[model samples]
Target: MTGSPALSSRIAELEAELAELRAEQAREADGAMLKVLLDDIEKRHAVERRLHRAEEWLHLAEEAGRVSAYTFDFATGTLDWSPSTLALYGFPLDEQPTLGRWLAAIHPADRPAVQAIADHALQHHGDVDHRFRIVGPGGWRWIEDRGRIVRNEDGSAARLVGINIDVTELVELERRASLDGERLRLALAAGRNACWDWDLVTNQVTWDQQLGVLAGVADFGGDFDSFWALVHDEDKPRVRAALDRALATGSDYRVEFRMVREDGSIRWTFTQAKVVQDADGKPVRLVGIDSDITETKLAHLALNESRLFLVSVLGASPDCIKVIEPDGTISFMNSNGQLLMDIADFEAIRGKRWVDLWPAEAAPLLEHALSEAVAGRRSRFDAACPTAAGTPKWWDVSVAPITAEDGTVERILSISRDVTDRKDADDQLQLLNAELHHRIKNTLATVQALARATLRSHSDPAQFEAAFSSRLESLGKTYGLLRSGPQAATLSELVEAELGPFGGRSDALAIGGPEVLLSSNAAVSVGMILHELTTNASKYGALASPGGKLAVDWTIEDGNVALSWREHCGDPVAPAAPASDGGFGSKLIDRLTRQLDGKVTRVWSDDGLSLTCRFRQSAD
Candidate 1:
């Protein structure tokens, strides 16, 4: 407007033209906006129609599904059950629901358990999906209840929402299926399984294909009389009676009878039947199974016969035969064994420890033999084992290991034979032989000692023979005395035998002593000593001269035999004193005294030679 009037006037017309175009554009935009708004309304209406249809379908599904929805308000402590829930509990649509009425509908037997489960879920904010029985207007029904805890922002349970479903039909189907399964299992357990069905009202029979094939009749008759014809004539009455009892009581029928097969052979069979009843408890049908038990029956009979044979064989054995368990306990003992062990009743000892029956002192021996057998080895022992009645007897026992299938020792068989007589005879024989051996050996030893002494004293062979023969004669006499008793000679006997040759014939010999006995071995030692002294006296001292005298005396001192031997020469001066360690006579006397376990002391005086010896008692 300030630039020029003509420019201002053109600008006004352009402004009006721009205003008209903007206004027309606004009108077009308004119409398009209205169209968009209408389109939005149509889409919303379509979604709403789908949603409403879905809700209606849901309600119908809830009714048909036998399910009811429920919600419990935690704060208000109010429970709301949907219309379907009321119908499930047999309540009218307008019935007011109450907690007490809901509780009363639960079956008495299931109330405590259901309440416990509900309480646990509530305390732990847990989900619940379980089934229980309830008595409703529709009668006893099974209910499947499920619930989820609705949590607030803080995760606290604000409400419990769940559904209840009537599951009575499902429960009944499960129970019937379980019963049928049990019947099938029983049929399978029966040997040579076959099935049959009989209709009581029509008296008609139906056989499974397996039964017909087994009966040798693919086109088997479908009547009660045809089924009865299969049973043996002798068993017909008993089987009919069983069937009658089952029908009368509506119970099961079981009987074992004989049936003639197509091969014209009679075999045993076990037949069992279940009676089916109608709603009024009337027997309507009989379902049964037949199992052939011929093989089993024959096996049992054979086993019994075998057992009798084994018992007879065992009874015939005289020896004590015992069967021991792997644990070293008595399992069985044969009749003869029971008598031997003094057991009146085998039952009294059954399961008793086998080792305990033996004496405690013999436990070590018995246990050692048992271990050997347990290690799969055979063992034997001969010992004096007494019976229960305390009768002493010796036995020769053999233990053999009995192995099982796995080759481990499972049992032990012990056989004991009485050996008392043999043992006694052996012991007596041993004692006699010992006595004979001692006598022979003693004689030989004495001969050797005499020969050695004589050779030591005499250098000439003839002189040695003369001296040795004389000593041998004295030894022979000593043996004669020993033979008079038990390989032993009295002290007096030994002394007299030796001195009699030198001084017994004359009054010059003197002897004094109490009765003292010496063993055969000790007698030999003392005899040698006496013989040496006599020889020495006869050669040089007393027996060499007429007036020489000899005196020998023995006494017990300190539980030992002490012997004193003295010689008188009848000369003023001592007969030249015998060399201490020189002559054979002196050495022989010293050695023999030591052999007697005695010490010797000698003194030479004006009289002659004096000697003393002490020897202990001995046994040959």
Candidate 2:
């Protein structure tokens, strides 16, 4: 920590030099020559102080920002390397190298640029800011050298001060980045481009090779003016104004402007620049790259056109197409859907729940389908539903789940078709078939009865044919009327249909019964049985006289049917004849009663005959 007394005395002598400088400035104001000399000494002293302070700063900076320092004294014709700088090159301070020795230590490939930069600074008295390579203990390393010439009192070059930063890693990263940028620029420049830079400190401009080409310059020619000259007249002012605002606000730079190409054709170019600021918070530089996004713009236009086409198709589709969520929330509905719901305003129905639009009974089915769809199942179902105005309709619906990339169900695609008309037609056909079967069965029975009756009575074939056809036709009409009831025909309707041919007025037939619904089979069987009984009665029972009246009563008791028929007046009462040896009418009634799984009881009365039949009663 201690220095020789002579070294300390040398420091005191340097302090005296500073004192002399102060004294000279104060005492020799009127002596122009003295004043000049004093100014010169003071300048030299300041340089000395700066050199000392710069040395201290270099050490501090080396530790602070991991950089070192060096200088070349042209007056002494020697290189003064700081201890840290020498240490960086693997040289100890006592073994300090000469200027030529240090230069020789630089890698051969880098020495040329390193020497040239220093030479240029000495020759022009200007500053040198450049990068060079130095071979050290750590192998070849990058060094950033920035120096300015210090002039002597006699206006001669005296010294140079510079800082060297170990920028090996920074340089490598920069090299890779530069390569990447070059690759990107070349790839993007198959069309055209304009690259620019704005120095916030000096407001100076820089351009790249593509800028000249985009501006129609035949060659780069290393000129900035060429780029400015080709800026379109309409875009020049705007670009200038934008740059001004960017500088003032330190905001990101972005602009789209037209630049004339080499062939004098104009193409739009877009540029986006980013500013780098100094420690003082002032933007020091901006680097920007320009590219043509024309194809991207054109694609957006085509996409819009395609979307319009799809929208038109959706609006016109015949099926009641609706876009709905898995939970049955409706998002969109086509024209057919609007019509099906009787909604003239589709907007009013948007976002409504699909189940709410359907009959309440259908809600459970809808919920089940939605749950299955969410579970990733495809489901389909058919339902009879009432619409908004309570008009019943049938719909066949299909649903499938659509999922996102992560396999989460995102939407359910549902399609439904109204099949009410088809269903109605099918029901009508079934009814017709059933009715046809009933008619054929009754007609066959009638023919059978007529054949047997004609044989037993020795009637002629023509008479049998006339009687059988007439009776069967009457049965056919009766069956038709009974089949068309509100729900199921009443016992009275059944009797009237079968005996209407007998001139039985409404008042001539009496009916009493609890309400019951008859299945089609039961209806047909009951009608035919009544027809047979009435046909025989006209010839033998109460209905045979104008004063005679028929009474019918029925009740559903303990799930079984009890029915009674009373025939009075037309014929005199006779004792019950045991089972007739073969009356065609008797046989037919017996067969129908058996077909219904019932029993028939006949009572001979003075007034008429009463027939009662009991059977199971079933609902349709």
Candidate 3:
């Protein structure tokens, strides 16, 4: 609407003012809108920067942790893998990813279980956390996957997004640690050892089931004092001291002590412990194992007793016994053995080579014997072992192997006996036997010659028989005296033996002789002579009559033996004159006298007959 001129001017001015105001209001509204727009853009830039930083951090964490992100589309059965995931699955980067390929990358043996778990997670739309093995060009790798299933609006499975981590090193470490723990447990069980842990502050003790069994306790409480009380009275102070020292010095503790069980039986325990300390270096815990060592301790005691018994037996042995090591060194020798070896001090010969103790000539033989013994064969040899004083002696040495429990040759046991005297005696006996054989052969020949001559001197068959019988009897008596004596005989014994058959009456026969032993040869000759004289006397000289008397005497003069024979109070005897057939008795007397290297003279007197013979003494 238009106004009057004066009114219209004012109205126009007011309208102008109102229009300016409106314009100003409009300008204010536009500036407020621009401010709001600028604030929104800055806020968006800040959010974008924060998102970028978060992404960078996440990528850094994934790389540092060897983790990879992956996604699987359930509808298309498609799989997507990060670079790291592809490397883990041994898939080339250029290769297309698929669910089938991912399943194929799983270890054949683990594929079924992995697929079932993944299918369960997909159907349930649940989260997944699983560990599985993947086979690749690099052998095998362990993977830890954690993800959640994404669902569509209708709750059906859509896809799976997850992070895969290469946990091969961790898995290997866990496997090795588990194996080591199993091995340790097995070893402890085999050794009859028990594990224990102690809390130093509370003085509380914890023991495994094995420890309770060892203590004969059905249910052992964690009372430290009860265990301490189980220690033997004699070992309590020692055990306490050891623990104190270990705790004070932060050192390992090891001790062997006797423990008293609930049944009052004693057991040997070997404990090894490590002290665990806190940051302040104060001991807080003690971890250790206790091994039952009663059997081992008893065995050691038995071994010591056996060793003592062996030493006693060796010391008392009569033979020289030596124990040589496998290297031929003399390991042990008893007192008796040392004495036999003429060594006053055992230490002088100890640790010395066994072969070096023998003379050079015997060393090789001893070495060979030792070798044979070491090879499981017993060897025996006789050697001349010279003493330290240079006295030669013979020894019969036997070498035998001493074996260990494993049938390995541990040492050679050598036993020696002295046989020097026995050897000498044997040699002497051999010589005497040879001489006796020669003497017996010569005697037989002489007897044969006498028998033939005796037969030749006789005429009548009956007379030849009687005369040969008497002569043979005389020869037999001579041999008997020589055979019964030891290399020699006394003349008086021969006379007594020859006259024993005639008469044993002292009044009828008189024999006198000095104590003279005759040589083996001379004794035979003298026996024959005595036989002849006694026979002649008994037949016709003195012994023929009841009142006849015979006297025989022998004397030693200047190393010569003189013997005389006289007959009396009997029918008078006369010497037979030389004839073609002289009596065999006479011939025997003459031959025997010549054999003695002596002379014989005969005198036929009125009262009696007398004969005298002289010879050099030849008895040894």
Candidate 4:
């Protein structure tokens, strides 16, 4: 349908205008869409930057704290680990994450329990907190794991996410601390000491279990005053003073005191304490240890008494007793020893070497003896000790080593005795014994010779018996004279003793001689000669007649002795008989003269008989 021209033109213009407005609206909408897209892109970039920063912070936190994050999927049996988690497990990034691999990383000893714990947490959808060890390339590492389980829709366990922390250093420190505590306890037990702590502000005391045992109490109340009251009355003031001094000077306290036990018995205790000071240097607490020392104290006292007794005994000894140090110094010498050395002061020789005390000639021997004794051997010797007075004295010395408990030589002990008098007496006895032996032998030989002669001279048994008895009686008298004197007999004494039995009258016999001491040999020989001569005169020579007379005289000259025997007023005598064919009396005179190393002469005359003999005057 054709409309009017004016209406047609307006409709056309309206359509064109509508077309232009629609194009403008479409351009505006496209520009708005571009603005929204740019805003979204900027917001995403900001979020990316923040995410990068957060990831870096988390990595730094994990490394600093030694922590690693892990996730486990139960259904898939898979494990996921962060970079730090892999490093903690000693696994490289290229290694695949799996439950088996994670379980393999756990220490063999703890694997079974760790797996069980993880399994229980997964099944029960429970939280997990466990500490365990894991094997790594470096070594074993302790791990503390904490995680929360995620459940599925059916309320069953699904997954686990957790953090793992390396606690190796912490575990090692804890273990060391535990060992130190145990060592301290053992030390206290071994020492039999108790540890105590006292607080000054609260006046409260704390004691270890050992202290309670020492106090003889099961439940010890930590009361300071009560513990002080247990101290002995004599020791209380000392203990209090020590504590006060320690507190005032902020120093360590040490004291030894006595305490009364529950049984009312006394016990010695050694206590030491350190004052714990505050910031202002005021004492706040005291820490100390106490030990029982009753046995030690008693032993020391007993040792002192024993030493005193030993000194007393040594001083009372009569022998020359000395104690020498190992170095040869004279450590101790009794009074007798000092007197033996002629030293008035013991200090003069106290520190002197033992060898120096003796003469130089005996020093070597003394040194050898000391060395032997120090080597733990006993030594003995006889030595001539020159005293301080310069007199040589003989001594029998003995040295013995004194040993300590450890089998080492501690000192040398020496004892000396004077033997001079004993030695002199022994020498005298020896001389006398030899003289007696010689005299006995000569007497026996003479008796034998006399018996033989008597047998030959007498044919009748009765006559022979009387003659032998008379000779034996004369021999017995001579022997008695020899025995009466110590060294020798006087010539006059011997003559009187032998002749007194026959006829001691001056009218019948005359005896004259100078005073002379005859040797033992000479005395015996002279006595026998006189006895024979007297018997002969009495029998047949001169004394047999009433008017008979006998003369006997002796003289000494130039160490020679001359003796004469004369008889007169008797029967006429015959020529002197040869000694070989002489009777027993004549043979005896010849033999006795020969023994005397002299000569005998017999002259026969009508008036009487005369005899002369000469010998050395061994007679003193």
Best by TM-score: 4
Lowest-scoring 10 consecutive residues by lDDT in candidate 1?
1-10
C-alpha RMSD of each candidate structure in angstroms: 25.7, 12.4, 17.1, 18.2
On a 0 to 100 scale, what is the lDDT of residue 506 in model 3? 57
Q: TM-scores, in order shown?
A: 0.39, 0.45, 0.46, 0.49
Residue-wise lDDT of candidate 1 within 1-620, one digit each (tens)?
02223234545665565566556666776777666655655665576566557546656767689877777767776677777788788888767666677777898998888888877876777888989987777689899999999999998888888889888999999999999877775665554678889999999999776676556565778999887888889998999899889999988899988777777877777888999999999999999987777788788779989988988888888888889987889888889888887878989989988889877887887898899999999989887888888888888999999998999988999988878778888975784475356445545644664455456557899987777777678766765664434577788988888665443235778899999978877877777677667656665566555577888898986659989988887853334565454664565567667766678888887678888888886734
Q: How accurate is candidate 1 locally (lDDT)?
A: 0.76
Lowest lDDT 10-residue stretch of candidate 2: 573-582
Residues forming the 10-long window of minimal summed lDDT in candidate 4:
572-581
Give the local distance difference test score of model 3. Answer: 0.77
Q: What lDDT score is found at residue 175 in candidate 2?
A: 91
lDDT of 1 at 429: 77
lDDT of 4 by residue, 1-620 (tens): 23323334555675565566556666776777666655655665576566557556767778899988777778877776777888888899767677787888899999999999977876676888999999876899999999988778998777787889999999999999999988988888788799999999899999999877666667767878878877899998899999899999998999988878778887788999999999999999999998877789789879999988987887777678989999999988887777877888888778888888787888877898999998899999988877777877888899999999998999999998878777667765774575456446545545564555466667799987887787678767766885634578777887777655444235778889898778877887787777666555544456544566788889988767899988884554333222224765576667767777888988866656788988765633
Positional deviation of residue 363's Cα in model 1 after best superposition, in angstroms: 1.7
Q: Residue-wise lDDT of candidate 3 within 53-154, one digit each (tens)?
A: 754665676779988877777887767666667777888976778767788889888899999988887667678999999996678989999997878999
| Candidate 1 pairs with clashing backbones | none
**Position 555, candidate 1: lDDT:** 93
